[model samples]
Target chain A: MHASLVVSGLRKVYEGSGRRVEAVRDLTFTVDAGELVCLVGPSGCGKTTLLKCMGGLLTPTSGEVLVGGRRVSGPPPGMAFVFQEYGRSLFPWMRVGANVELPLKQKDLSKARRRELVADALESVGLADAAGAYPWQLSGGMQQRVAIARALAYEPEVLLMDEPFAAVDAQTRADLEDLVRRLWRQRGITILFVTHDIDEAVYLGERVLILSASPTVVQEQLKVDLPQERDQLRTRVAPRFAELRTHVYEQIQAAKRGEPS
Target chain B: MTDIPPEPTRPSAWGSLPLRVLFVFALPALLIAFWWLTSDGSTNVYWPPLRTILRTFPDVWTRARLRADLVPSLLRLLAGYASAAVVGVALGTVIGSYRKVRAVCEPVLEFLRAVPPPVLVPVIMLFAGIGDTMKIVVIASGCVWPILLNTVEGVRAVDSVMSETARSYGITGPARMRAVVLPSASPQIFAGLRQALSIGIILMVISEMFAASNGLGFTIVQFQRGFAIPDMWTGILVLGLLGFLLSVVFQLVERRVLGWYHGLRDSSRRSS
Candidate 1:
């Protein structure tokens, strides 16, 4: 199967005022069409750098990222990113509905079509009544949901989420994880989700790509063999789930200790 | 997980509705009462009694004077203020958005801003002539500085995340500026506008006082020159009233335009 997104030999070095730091070094990965891939790593492992490079928000020092077979030098079309900081990502001045509809205005769609898409997106996120409410008026979890609805409304072929549930409570995080899985299954859109939580990586992703510490590279890729249908209660307590999470956790500990992948 | 948290309610710093109203008007009312009591039947020439000024107010500001003086003055003020707002916002957005432009214009802007605007009335008159244009130009010149400078700062301070979000979604050019940039920078822009309004008023009266046949400032000068002490006092009162009225109107517009801003700030403050 052809890959929908490809990162080849991606390297990003920050050089400023006579100080140099290599954030991401020689990273290579791929996400096939309709695949849900999670990227996990130790803190400061440059997951954000890789994601930004893939999303075309940041240019790689040496190498290339291809989305839909086209090289990404700048933010490419039909791709959306959900930042960890939802408070900053969402425009506070816009209402929940307007925030979702903002990107749709860029597409060549009729007003009725745009309105329909916005309504459907909001409804999917269970925020249909919050259309007129400003983002800050809602709770942290609800605001993040609005951000997701915005990405959904854009009808993106590839969605990139960077630690999207990091700031929410554990219960809300579980609910949002389910929401993501459900949406991915329903829409069949490719997603590259980045996180540092081992259990979350094991739970949400079909395949997990673990990275080494700073000046990072992919340490390992482990596929989940658990049942396809996952629930917060049962799947989490399953013996196989425990085993996979343990392997991921140990790999991350080794990475942090500077063991070569 | 099913229900969202309720919106936080803001604690009122000022108590009940009636008490809040009283708090707002108490000082001004006390001052007015003191003036009325102290100035009752005064024999002073320059400081006429409060009743004499109030009585002369209608006679001095008759319908003819309203049309000939007050109307023209306000029209010039409106034209100058509107022009200043447009030019200030336009130029400020450009200057704020580009680093090179900001660097090149910073020193020149600082120097220009330092020179008191009233001092420029003579220079403006030389170019705009001793007509309404001169008065309008003078007002606009003073008003533009605050609005322009504030706009530049606001534009510079636009949130990076929001800007990146706009770009990632293919929202660019004028659409991005209008939807993302301008709204993000509006709070600072409004602050500048508030400052410019008062500056606009000051420049209006000063320019009229320098050279004009009829205006609030001109009429006040005429009254002083003709020894119409009560009439002069009334003209001053009219100027004060006009400024107060314009400020109230500006506050209403600002509240409407910045409702989201206030709501966001209040919510964040309460949550934190």
Candidate 2:
């Protein structure tokens, strides 16, 4: 059974240094098993806060996140997070293969089985030959692929990505987006991707959840009706894609202007 | 990744292996040559001729003397250095990991660190007595501060993202410390170790000079008092040679342990 991720009435407030700011005011959403969902918002909309709370990296001030019906007080067993800062997330001291295999060391798998999973994950991410190379030896895009490969090797049921491609160049970002879609289709791993890029959310997800600016709440959830077998060239240029992106873009602008959802 | 040029893992700034070796040895060779020529036949009462000191080297550092002085001195150095390293890293990790521990320990650590370790030789001897225990404790007391302080700084500076990444992946307890904390802190830790090596040698000699018995420092002081000028110079030379040899070994070990760190730094430097 695929594990579905649930976040209900999640609220997070940062309290420190005599200042209290509500980062994620109220967020309620459910990403069905094997489904890909993208969260988009204005720059200060607390998409990261919401994602961190859901991933159990940060404690919510209220409500709860559930993966496969089990409440997450801390990082849940079936979940994995792909940080936006791949350069920091990866251990510079470890080679690509070792970085990928690190998470699996905690699992019940044998050493041979762990190696097999590492190889398969690297092969899937088009980084099979980079196993011996350190993370800094590769390009920014390749480093991110290694990070994704690391998550994949863990065989996690729920993958949470926090604007993973934000630091790469435009061309590399496109390639990574396609890589995510391909991996999602092949593996059927439930993914919750967070980004501020409206077009990226439209191009990648089955559904896009847009968030309001700071002290955030879900502004809207728009269904992406593009055919399942989508590609960069044709799908992006489709009339429906334009309408959907424009709608999401307008909603983000409205959120920035303090308009009610 | 392949498009990137081959990394210059060793510093290639000078170019060519033979030339690099030449550059490394050039200054030391010139200095030694100057010493040999200047101190050739002429001799002061205190400063013997270079040839006299060389001749006395075989006589003064015979197998018997080496066994009595050099071997015990080295063993004590090794024991003290090993203990300092273990305690420094262990205690430093705890202090660095916890704010309350660091807060309580900082003032005391700073006060103790500020006191010159050689001055504590008499104080340590009072407690442990004039024996191997006192010498090892003296070496350890001096050596631990650099290592402990450096480990604390290194552990404190471990990147937050790396910590979060480890935590998210279910790497906890000893696994987390091994896979994440230690490696992250090791570059600084090695720096501390490098500093401690020389300090350990200094303390070794200082502790020996303070009191009774046979050791390299004790032998040197005895030669000086008895006016065996040439033998004294030989003892000084042995200490210098010992320091040089230990340093060479330390570098080899460091190269192996921190190969990845150097590679990472070099690549980052080139990219930026």
Candidate 3:
């Protein structure tokens, strides 16, 4: 069964060096079941911190994150997080298949079932042949794909990706974006993707959640009015796509200028 | 920029395997030839002829209970080194993972590490007696520091993201250590093990030298004291060969263990 996520009045304050730096303040948002939502923000705007809080990786100073209506205390069940640093995220010593199959070890699945899932996940990411290869043997984009395959193999109801495509080149980034959308549609998994790139957020998300600079809060929630059946070429060229991209772009620029939303 | 000439390509060292082997052996071969020629018939008290030493090697090694002595020394070395490796890696993981433990134990460990193994032979002899136990203890004490320190460094230096990934995947406790932590720290641990090997060898010799026991070190010292120059040279030569052989075997194991690390490093370097 798929799950949705809701974050309410979330605030995280880092108490270090005898000073408290407010990272995320009063950040409130929701992603409905089977919906793909992107949270876009400027650099150093506490997007990663907020995502960490939502994923239950970090304890918030106040407020709460609800996954499938349950408060998140530790890493929430039925939810997986894909970090931005793919190189650091994947185990270098593990082969591609082993890396993907790691999370499944926690599940009460038979060896055959686990193998099947690993194969399926690798095939989905187009890394079926690279299963025996180590992560370091592959290129950056291929490594990130292995990471995505890892998340996919977990068979989570919700996937939280933090700037997943940011480290790759332009061509690879575009290819990965399409792969994410395809996976989302095929599995009906709720996806909460975070990124600093305005175009990436616009290109991926059905609903783009704009976040302001620190102390961070939701600035705007812009809905993409593009067609359900979308392609990178036709969908991006649509006049509606251009309008939405501009709106998100202007919102980020204004947020950068410290304008109160 | 236009006037700058392109750099010339150096000749590849891998032109031929046989040629490369010959190149590496040329100096040692020449030295051996010189020694053989100079000392063939000379009757120096300390400086035994290479031929005399070579002739005595088979006699000492086969008939003079040298093989029996070799067994005890090898066994002690293996026992001490193995125990050290196990204890070092286990304790290192704990200290490295926890900050409080590291802070508490670091000073005492540092003090112990600073004391050379040879110096402690007398102290160990008094406590353990000049037996197999004492020799093993000396080797273990001497070799543990490198492994422990390297493991601590390796575990501490493990990328936080890797651990976080493991945690996110619900891999924690012993599973986390076995799957993520150990593998990540292996390259460094192997490096520490390499350092420990030579130290173990040195301690093996030192420990035997001090006590009333049978070992290569004891044999060497006995031969020297009795003015058996050829036999002493044979012992020295055998010890040197032993060191060389151990290192070669160790390198083969290390290569297998750290094959992934090397591959990753090479690929990244090539890309960069």
Candidate 4:
């Protein structure tokens, strides 16, 4: 497994209102290429701040983010981010095809290739017919799909998603999670997914890294030994699935109590 | 005008049809009714009846000579509006992006915005001379503030999340403005444009009134001097009609251009 990203001792401090707030501290992690890892934590646990640092959307005070072995000073060109607010993530004025096409345009791809990629990305999200439709015209699920298509069309080496399915309905969230898994497997792109949903993390991540709330620290990284193929019904009912979920749940409980692991 | 509505047609017609029908007919009908009632006698010489105005309208509308005057006034209005849009948007973007620029310019712009357009007419007339250039300068100066102020508002109000998302994609500079910033700010910018257009029309009519050999304003004054009441009424009615039609046309274009934007539920819709 090749490391697609390396975060070493990352920290971010924001100053305002006559005070200082440390959002993240002493964070270190590495994601291998084509490896899907989910960061699970309580709300306001600096999960977003950590993602921003990793993606180069925010600067860290005294640390570095390495993408494909190069230190990321600003948003690294090879990584794409899918934000939670589908309402805001996609540009409302551009057509769905154009929204997906925008990031690709930044790449050195030819116009024909760009067009082909945009078309394929939209199709993969089950939004093939929505190419000409604007972002506002689609339902929430469809809008999120457009956002995904935008990230996918960039053909980023690593896709960092921050609660990408939180805003959508539960049914849509399940479908989207499956979609992410399929895309990760098919493209072999590294993924760093941040979510507060324990089931979602366990269901989607090859490895789930749980963190403690407020001044977050990594509590544990649990390897999911479930079979490669997953199902909503059959797989969820298995004994190993329950055991894995219980173990992750206990870790979270321990985190909440500030208990020694 | 009869075939199209200026406002968007939303799904579910529940009372929307009648509301739109009222929007279509109310203002013009009310204006006409006022003209008809007032024309009964010269209760106030400034006001004239709809019939008298309608009868006198053709004399002004049909005259081949009046077109020259109308054309010059229109040219001045368009030049001023175009210049304002270009400069206002350019300056607005800069001022909006940079805090220091905004702090320096905001006070000066506010003072300019407050100093009514009529005061500038005389000053511009002196500097630019009694030509179309003077009128254009005055009109452009008069019209620019609203567009600039509104552009600033739109740009300042840009959703930060969108900007961050754009940055994450390595989108910056002009590409970011074109793709992310401009579209996000457009609804507000167009609002400014709409207001500027209204001001432009007012300045168009006013500049002609201040001093012009032709144009609708000049025609009104010239007729009043000759005691052509009907002709005077005709010119005023024409001004009213032009203002109404211009607003409708603008709204139509705004809706078409901002189709994606207007549908966005005013954004705080998450609560609903």
What 10-residue stretch in candidate 1 chain B is worst by lDDT?
Answer: B1-10
Query: DockQ (Cα-based) per candidate?
Result: 0.67, 0.64, 0.40, 0.50
For model 2, what is the alpha-carbon lDDT of residue B172?
86
Q: Compose the digit string of candidate 4's lDDT tens values, residues A1-261.
A: 779989888878888999998777667878888899998976787998888888888888888999999999899999999999988778878888888888776778899999899989877878877787767767787788889889998988889999999989999888888899898888888999988888888888899998876566777889998888987776678898888888888988887776646
TM-score for chain A, candidates 1 onward in order:
0.98, 0.97, 0.96, 0.96
Question: Which residue pairs of candidate 4 clash?
Answer: none
Model 1 local distance difference test score:
0.91
TM-score for candidate 1, residues paired by index: 0.97
CAPRI-wise, candidate 3 is acceptable
Candidate 3, residue B242: lDDT: 91
Candidate 4 versus truth, CA RMSD in Å, comes to 4.1
Off by over 4 Å in 2: A1-3, B1-8
Superposition error at B145 for model 1 (Å): 0.8
Q: Which regions in candidate 4 have their CA more than 4 angstroms from the true location?
A: B1-9, B12-23, B30-34, B41-50, B266-272
lDDT digits (tens) for residues A28-124 of candidate 1 = 8888999999999999899878888887888889999999899998898979989888999999889888999999998999999999999999899
Instruction: Report the poorest 10 consecutive residues by lDDT, candidate 4 chain B.
Output: B1-10
lDDT tens string, model 1, B1-272? 33644554557889899999999999999998999999998899999889889988888788998999999999999999999999999999999999999999999999999999999999998999999999999999999999999999999999888888888999999999999999999999999999999999888889989999988889889999999999999999999999999999999998889988988999887778
In the predicted model 2, the residue pairs found to clash are: none
Model 2 over residues A102-177: C-alpha lDDT tens digits?
9999889999999999999999999888898888888999999999999999998799999999999999999999
TM-score of the second chain, each candidate in turn, equals 0.95, 0.95, 0.91, 0.87
